[model samples]
Target chain A: MKGLIVKDLLLIKENWKQLLIFVLIFIVIGLEGNQILTFVPVFLSLMVLLSTFSYDDYNKWNSYAVTLPNGRKNIVRAKYIASICLSAFAILFTYLLITISGMMNHHLNLEETAVTLLGCWSAVVLLQSFMYPLIFKVGLEKGRIFLFVFFIGVSALLGLVFQNIKISLPVEVISFLNHYLVIILPFVMIILLYISYKISEKIVQKKEF
Target chain B: MNAIEIKGLVKKYDDKFQLGKLDLTIPKGVIVGLIGENGAGKTTLLKAILNIIHIDSGTIKINGEDNKKEEKKENIGVVLDNMFFPEILTAKDIELAMRGMFKKWDTQVYYNYLKEFELPLDKPIKALSKGMRKKLEIITALSHHPDILILDEATSGLDPVVRNEILDIFLNFIQDENHTIILSTHITSDLEHVADKIVFIDQGKIVLDQDRDELIDHYGILKCDPSQMEQVKKEDYLCYKKNKYDVEFLVADRDKTRKKYPNSVVDKVTLEELMLLMIKGVK
Candidate 1:
């Protein structure tokens, strides 16, 4: 496990600059720029993760991992642990930057800042819990293609509906979302994460190379 | 106890290939060449032995323990055509990785192999040429001083000069009379001089497995006039080939036949000739 973590840390060391850029971009999103693009950094982090995954795929390193002294379970666990750690890092980085910016602007409050950061991390985890399992099942390339097309199609359809009609979200619905997101989103995402582990084990077992 | 043993090891990939119930015993202290045609389960057998490929049904033992046991890997070192290292890592990084990964890793020996192989220790693995990358892998695998080594097509891409140099290292390792190697290669001569035993696998079954000297002495290549081919005992030859003008058959023993047919052109057989004759069959 320590060896696996060292490997991951070396990878992170190679990409520290990019990770810093992600934090900078998100701080900009939270502080001064359009709030809409705050999702971009977390989303962009996936590209870094995807590129790493691509490196592994192209090199056929996954097969080698199993051949090592490490067990297949550790190989899979290392990947998930790497992903989870990165997710937490992004959450911490984004939260700290936002809080610092707020203090500089003299509008800093602890509760609201914590809430926003929690929201960002939760949303990213929820999306990852869905997307990563798909990636594991189908592979990084095909899964990314399917997910990209589906995300775009859904976004466009939502845009079209919004443009064609004006149905303002009710106050009750907004309050329900705010109150329920913390309780509902994580529970669902955790279950999905567990399912992904099971699916990943099955995929690793059956993979030929 | 055998260093390695396999019983009823069956692996099938649809109609492409099948390794059916392979029974093998590799005792300690000898190099074994696994010779086979392309897609003949040379790599598949290595993979199955390493548990890199899923097996249908069978048992594999290493040092009298199940090969599947995590602790068993401590005694096994493997080199394949595939790159096992991450692209971004340098040889120095690998030294660190291996130190943590393998309890027996010897840094001095690792660098010695790098110096011997002329592979740069500071260059990123991806930046190195194919041969250099392979050298790094060889260094890493050997650093742990595994009792048994398994190499799959490990020497194919290397130039003859480099291959010869590496073969010298293999010979040195076997001098201990306790280390073993299962080398898989199409270049029959690569393992020809070094391998103690040769196992010819064709379409996933053991076509031939015998001690090198014994097989060489027993297996004689007899070239004769085409018309004289029918006179040779059919059962005595493992297989034979015929051209319009000449005939060549690999007989199991030269001395036995020499006593019977002094005039027959009986010559020593090579692993390359044997492999080709076996694969091409009588044509």
Candidate 2:
């Protein structure tokens, strides 16, 4: 597993300049808007994870990986580990940016910021959980198409919710769901991520080189 | 103990192609050359042994244990026709990755091979030529000190000089009495130079499995007319092909056949002739 991780890290390192440019662009966009800063890291981390797959696919590395001592199961696990690490880095970057911006702009609200950060983390986890199984099943190219369609569908649903649903939830109900979500979402996402990992393992195990 | 054992191994690609009930045993301390034409299940058999592709129904044992075990994989090294390293990674990066992967990885030996092969440590794999990439693959495969080395067309695209250099490395690899190699190739001449045993496959069936010298020494092609062909016993010949003028018989026992047919012209069989006769001749 360590070997597989080293390989992935080296692959990512090759594109460091491209990633740095992405970070710089996001940082600039982030200064103008706090939401962009909060969400871009999650997006960037996912892109980084996807780029590793692209490299793997290009050289058919997965076929070679099966011949290695770690085998296919560990290969799948290594991708998940890489994704988790990248997501963690993105979250840390988001936190630092938000903290710095908060210090510079007194108008930022701490309570609202905490809720938004939690939401960002949940989104990243959910995206990974959704994308991983698809990638394992159909591979990165087809999985990317599915992920794109899913994102578009989600955005459309959100647009509908904001545009058509004028009725507001009761304050008691809103507070109840929000309080429970803060506690429950992370646990649920973790469980879902575990299940996703297992599914990916099964998919990869059945795959022919 | 044999380095590899397969019992009733069957893999089906589709209706037209299938490896049916194949059984083979490759003993330790020798190079077993797997000779076959394109689509003859050479790669399929290699992949099945490595567990790269799932077998439909079969048992594969490596070094007396089930080949599927992770521990068994540690003793095996593989090089496929297509190099699998990430193009963006340098040879040094591969060393780092392999050090973590193989428990028996020898860093010093790896560097030595890199120097010997003249592979640049800093160049990305994509930047290297085809022959250079193959050399890198061979270096990694050898550095781990595996008990069994499985190569599928590892020398196909290499020039004669490079191929000879690689073959010399293979010869050196087998100097240890415990090390074994299963090299799959259509290049019969390469096998003739170093292989101890030869296993020929055609359309997923084992056509011939014999010692290298046994085949080279005893196997013969008897060229005779149709009337002379009739005089040769059917059981004595492995297979025979008839041209317009003469019949070519592939006999397993050359001296016996020569004694049996004193007037017939008997010629020594090369590995290429053996493979071609098995593939093209009727059973």
Candidate 3:
């Protein structure tokens, strides 16, 4: 499992120049205090992770990988571990960047930055948790297309429903949810990730490369 | 003990092709060459032995343990046709990853092979030529110090010089009395130089399997004129072909057939001729 993670990380390492360019672009655009900072970094990290899948596909790495000492379960486990590792790294880097930027601009609010970082990380992890099982089932290429269509369809349906229906949460209910969301979100993320990993494990176990 | 044992192994793809109800036992410490034409289930058999593809029905044992058991596979190394590490990775990256993946990965040996093969340590695999990539894959399989090596088309595309070099490596590897190799290739010439045993698969079945020396010594092509061919009994030859000027028969025992028909020409058979006669000749 560690070997698989190391392999993915090594693949990511090869693209450092491209990643550095992205960081430079983020730094320039982020000076305007745009909301892109938190989400973009998280998304960037996820894209980096997804590219590893593409690399694997292009080289037919999974066929060779299955022949290694690691079993199918370990392969799935390593991907999830690597995803979390990459996400955490992205969050920490963004946190430091935002803190330093905010300090330089005389508008530092560590608490607010923390909340935003948490939200971004949660969103990325949730997306990844959903995406991995699908990728394992249909492969990275087709899975990405399915994800795009699925997300667009869901968003459109939700948009139509909200546009037609008028519902508002009470202030107390919203505040109560807000107060506990940080605590609850982590548990939800863990459970979702676990389920996703299990599904991927099953898919890969039966998969013939 | 046998290095590998397969019983009633079967694999099917859609409804078009199926590989067995076949059984084969490969003894340890010898190079066994698997020879077959394209789409003849050579790769399927190799994959089944490796447990890369699940068999529809059958049991595969490696070193007397079920192939599904991961521990048994720890001492096995493989190079599947056109399958390997992502091309974007350098040899150095492979070294890092393999050190963690294999418990007995020998970095010193791995680098030694890389140096010996003249493959650059830092170049991405994509930059290497086809033969270089194959050499890398073979060396990677070797660096783990595996007790068994299973290779599918490991030398199909290389020039003769590189292929000879790789064959020498296989020869060296089999010096250990415990090491075994099952090399599948359509190129029969490669097998002629190094194989101890030959197992030929055609249309998902074992057409022939025998010791290399015995196979070469016993199998022969008996060529004769049309009238002379008439003297040959139906059961005497495995298969036969009719040419424009003469008729040719694949005889199982050259000396026996020569004695039986003194006037007929009983000639030695190459691996290629045997495969062709067995597969393409009329029974």
Candidate 4:
């Protein structure tokens, strides 16, 4: 596992500048997203985590890595752990900055802030769990295109129906942490991601090259 | 002790190629040449030995352990054409990455190869020439000091001078008797020079497996008239090729063929001529 982390760390260091800028754009766009950017860090971190698979896919490095001592299970776990850690880091960074700003404006609450961060964290985990397997099974270029078309088309059509239903401020998604499935969902995702790794390994093993 | 034991190996692709039930054994101290034309399952066989691909039904054992066992990798050093290291990485970066990965890694030996190969340690691998990239892979593969080295067309693209230097290094490596190498290539001349055993594969099956010197001695190229080809019995020879001007035959027994055709011309068979006659099926 340490070996796997070092491998990725080396790669991350080599490409950190480009990667930092890529994630910065996501955080900026998420800040301007429909929800006033309270959960922008969550999306930024999720995108970073999700895109790691694409980075591996850029060459046949995934297969080459599989040929090493660590094997594929560790490879999958490292990616999951890396993403989770990055996401947590992003949320912490966002919380720290927002707290400093809020303190300056004299409007800070500790309990509410933690709860909201956890809610957004759960959503990002859910999105990644559902999305990464597809990206792994297919690839990033096609998978991201499919993601954009499906969700954007659905939301565009729903915009008409949702306008009639009404809201105070774009359906406060952070309040949805009440469900028990949110807790079950992340574990289920981690498990599914693991299984996907094995499946992908098996598929890759059968490949000639 | 056999370095690698492959028995009843069968790998079939859907409507494409088939690796027959291959039975092969490479003893602990010899360099074996896996000679075949393109798409002859050389890479497939190498991949199967590494357990990078599952065989349909067969068993492969390496260094007394099942090839399927994950721990078997500790003893094997494999360099295939497609084992692409990230082009952006330098040899120093690879060194850092592989430090703890291989238990037997010799950093000094790795550095020695870099010096011997004259590779720029800090240059991005993408910036290195193709031969230099190959030297990089070769250096890394050898750094681990694996018991068995499986090379698949690994030296095909390099110039003869570099290839000869690397081959000399391999020859020195196999002098230990604890080291064994299986080199797969269509370039049979190199095999003729150094390979102890020549395993000729075609389409997917091991068609001819023989000791290199024994193979050279066993067969002779017979050049005769077309009429003389008709006179030679098919059962007396393994394969024969005929053109409008003359006839060529790959005789299993040079002495017998020489005796039978006293006026017939007999020429020594090189690995290249032997492969061409066999694959082209003697017209």
Go through the candidates in order and give the C-alpha RMSD of each one to the true structure: 3.5, 2.6, 1.6, 4.5
Cα distance off (Å), candidate 2, residue A169: 7.2
Q: Higher DockQ: candidate 2 or 4?
A: 2
Clash number for model 2?
0
Residue B35 miss distance in model 4 (angstroms)? 1.5
Off by over 4 Å in 2: A28-35, A107-111, A147-173, B225-228
- Measured against the true structure, the TM-scores of the candidates, in listed sequence, are 0.89, 0.93, 0.97, 0.85
**Native A-B contact fraction in model 2:** 0.75
Candidate 1, which segments miss by more than 4 Å at Cα?
A12-41, A149-180
For model 1, the local distance difference test gives 0.78
Strongest candidate by lDDT: 3
- Among all windows of ten consecutive residues in candidate 1 chain B, which has the lowest summed lDDT? B130-139
lDDT of 3 by residue, A1-209 (tens): 77888999999999999989988999877765665667788888899999999998888888888888755767788888988888888888888888778877888888988888888888888899889999988889899899999999999999999999987989998998889998888899889888988889999999888
- Model 3, C-alpha of B165: deviation from truth (Å): 0.2
Classify candidate 4 by CAPRI docking class: acceptable
Candidate 1 lDDT over A1-209, as tens digits, reads 54665676676567789778866766666776233544555556555666666767777776776677854666667667777777776666656665666677776676765666566766766567657666766778998888889889999999999999999999999899889876777677777777877777777766667
DockQ of each: 0.53, 0.74, 0.79, 0.37
Candidate 4 C-alpha lDDT tens digits along B80-155: 7756566677899888877756777789999998998899989988898878888888788888888888888878
Relative to the real complex, the DockQ score for model 1 comes to 0.53
Candidate 4 local lDDT, A97-188, one digit each (tens): 56765566577775667667767887776566656555655677887787778778888889987988875553444455344545665576
**Candidate no. 3 TM-score:** 0.97
**Model 1, span B1-283: residue lDDT tens:** 8888999999988877678778999999999999989988888899888888889999999889887786678778888777587878888887876777778889999988888788887778889987677767776878998988898887888888778877887888888778999999999888768899999998899989899888876879888898887888887687888767888888888887777667789899888888888888773
Fraction of true contacts reproduced, model 1? 0.53
Tens-digit lDDT string for candidate 2 (A26-51)? 77766554565677787778888788
Assign candidate 2 its CAPRI class.
medium
B148 Cα displacement, candidate 3 (Å)? 0.5
